[model samples]
Target: MRFTIGKLAKATDVLVTTIRYYESIGLLDEPDRSESGQRLYTEDAVERLAFIRHARDLGFPVETIRELIALQVDPGQDCERVDEIARHQLGEVQRRIAQLKSLETELKRMLSSCEAGKIASCSVLAALGHHEGCLHDEHGGQEVLAKPPSI
Candidate 1:
């Protein structure tokens, strides 16, 4: 059965703007327009949107998802390609986990160093202002006081 954009969004639990953005980005196909200009979708769109949502939830980038969709369309493609993508994503996740763990350790050290004194004597503030004074030598003498952006 045909469904409008709103219905599709409701059924897929995705926002209407996200759906439109996906279409604009070539991740989702442009649906048929109704007589009054409403977009009409079908079961295929629902299934595709679900796949997209699942990939997104798994942290796959849009470009990677586009490659996966291309592979899905071609039954002859080797499964190795998909495996490679997943493996790369796994490596990235591992790297981020390592970074987060380091951050946690550094935060703990800073917090523990605090003696409940005024801000002038706060170890946390001191560490923040002077990265060289960090307890750990993980950065090999380089400053790493600021948190890195998420991957």
Candidate 2:
């Protein structure tokens, strides 16, 4: 069955705009157009879109996905390259998890020490105000902010 972009987005839990953006970047090939010029997607197209979205959800960039798609097309080729890509992505995910755990520790320390004291003299403020220091290092880790930025 053919699907329109809206239907594809709903089925895949990806935004319509993101699907179009992927097409723009060549990560997803543009779908065929009907006589009315409406884009028509086949089952294969939908599956490919799902694959692209899944890879993006796992933090793989479009460029890498493009390569993976090519590797997927050539049946004679070994899938070892795909495994390497997955391994790299896994390593990256693990690194982020570790960084988040470290930041969580620092945040717990900062929050518990506050003691509900005056805002100006709060331990939370003291922790944040330390020059040249943070739960995340100057360069390493997720660098979580103590608070969200003002809108």
Clashes of 2: 0
| Candidate 2 structure quality by residue, lDDT tens digits, 1-151 | 9888888887877778887887888877889988999887788877888888777767786789899998987899888989999999899778767777887787787898878968878888888888344655642443432232211
- Which predicted model would earn the best lDDT? 1
Candidate 1 ranges with C-alpha deviation above 4 Å: 135-151
Cα lDDT tens digits, model 1, 58-149, are 77788999999999987986799999999998897676667667878888888988899998788889898887787555642123233332
Error of 2 at 104 (Å): 0.6
Clashing pairs in 2: none
- What is the model-wide C-alpha lDDT for candidate 2? 0.76
TM-score of each: 0.85, 0.84
Report lDDT (CA) for all predictions: 0.83, 0.76
